[model samples]
Target: MRLADKVILVTGSCTGIGKAIARRCVQEGARVVLHGLETEWGEAVREELGADKSVLVIADLQDEATPALLVRTALDTFGRLDAVVNNAAWVASSNIHTTTPAFFRQMLEVNTLSAFFLIQEALPHLKERRGAVLNIGSVNAWCGEPDLLAYSVSKGALMTLTRNLGDALFREEGVRVNQINPGWVLTEKEIQRKQEHGMPVNWYELLPPEYAPSRRILDPAEIAAAAIYWLADESGPVSGQVVELEQYPVIGRNPPKK
Candidate 1:
């Protein structure tokens, strides 16, 4: 049990990669605070993880005050807070032409600002415990597809935030901060989202090999597995790292090979 007796707070944990991270943390003996907008799914996860081991919190991160409230809730439920996984995000596909001020603001508020405030609110406790903060970023931060304009911008901002805070906090407060930029993970929400976008029920099975280098898209559990090392003490004082979790090299690659 790498995280034995740790108290971890994971946002957007009702489903997808967030849910998998929470589940994995619990399995590693960490008590968890699961936060999400989906009340039913959040409650279900609380039940599944067991009341004694986990608690559910429903929040809309867009609210400026929600981050503090979430941190307080986690502290109240458990005696202390050891780690926070900022996994909640808003992903709206919009290019420059389609992006309105309101939409852009909303995307930044949820995907970037929320994580900033959450870390701010949790800083005191994390510093006390010398704990870690794991931010779930996306490979799109490098340079997203045209369809993911706003999302890519938000993630890129998050990447910078991770680096800035990881260095500043570790040097000053002794709290470690790191981020993982995961590529194309096949989660429940993703499956449904793709379906709604007109992809067939068996779309994943039909994906070209080029789309998935290993003949399959990544899994939430695999991301969760990587998350554990960062969140746990075994990572040993490392910080300010933005790991790109993907099948292909993300940097210095041209369009493609003929």
Candidate 2:
């Protein structure tokens, strides 16, 4: 039980990578506060994790008041806050020409600014516990495809926030901050997205070597496994580091295109 007795607040916990992480946290003996927009999905996870081990908060991070509400939920439900996983994001396809100011602001509000404020509101509690913050970034942060300008930029900002706060928080408050940039993971939404793009049934099974080095995309559980180390006491003073969780090196690499 690496995270035994810890209370973690995981945003976007109703689905995708956040759901996997929340389940893993419970498995590792941590009590978690799960937040999401959908009440049914949040209820499902709350039921799965049981009332004793988890609490569900149905909220939209777009609200200016949401960051504080999440923090309050953690403190009220769990009695303490030990860690936070910022995993919620707004992933959409929009190129430079298509991205309007309002759309860009919406993306930033959901993907970047909310995370910053959540950490800010949680700072006092995190400082008390010498806690940790884990930001879930995307490999697209570096340079995205033409159709992902706004989403990529938002993630890029999140990456920067992780690093900036990782250093400042570790030194000043003894709270560690770090991030994981995951490659393509086969989440429920992703599969549905592929189908929307006209991919046939079971489209991911035969991925080309260039994208999936081993002919398979990443799994959400894999990302969750990596998250445990950072949130656990085992990582030990490591801060301001961003790890790429892709199958291959993200920088200066040429895939076989097989």
Q: Which candidate is the best by lDDT?
A: 2
Report the lDDT tens digits of candidate 1 across residue range 2-107: 9999999999999999999999999999999999999999999999999999998888998878888888888898989999999999876899799999999999
TM-score quality measure for candidate 2? 0.98
Candidate RMSDs in order:
1.1, 1.0
Per-residue lDDT of model 2, residues 38-112, tens digit only:
899889999999999999988899888898899898888889999999999988889979999999999999999
Alpha-carbon error at 147 in model 2, in Å? Answer: 1.1
TM-score of each: 0.97, 0.98
Clashing pairs in 2: none
* Candidate 2 accuracy as lDDT: 0.94
TM-score of 1: 0.97
